[model samples]
Target: MTCVSCRTGLDHCHGTVLLHVDGGAECTEPDCADAVLARHALVVDCDSIEGGCACEVTAERLAHAS
Candidate 1:
């Protein structure tokens, strides 16, 4: 799986916020929120994960949708 925040595609960090925009879903790690906001200049509804991170949550959601 790929991490949207670092974009490292490695399991280094977890995402904190799941950003839902017009086209697709994106995410940001706790430390990467500022960077993500700077890059994506669109209105997004942030979904907070209770125990999981955005990366894990989003992946699970996508899998279920499929």
Candidate 2:
């Protein structure tokens, strides 16, 4: 996977999520917010750090989806 931010392969660049966070304040997020949230959050990363995402693969997924 290549990082969308740096255009560097993930294997070479250190793994990190620029906007990653965990256990943030709970709120009733609207369903319509998925796209926006997905843009700002990493969906699968929640399992890694709890309520947070690592956005590492998103670039790859986005790259593939397109």
Tell me the alpha-carbon RMSD of every candidate. Answer: 11.9, 15.9
List, in order, the clash count of every candidate structure.
0, 0
**1-66, model 2: which lDDT tens digit per residue?**
645644743222222223333333222234332333323333333335555344535555777899
Which number leads on TM-score? 1
Query: Candidate 1, 9: how far from true, in Å?
Result: 28
lDDT of 1 by residue, 1-66 (tens): 644655744333344335542235555645553435445434345444456445556776788999
Residue pairs clashing in model 2 are none
lDDT of each: 0.49, 0.38
Q: Estimate each model's TM-score.
A: 0.24, 0.20
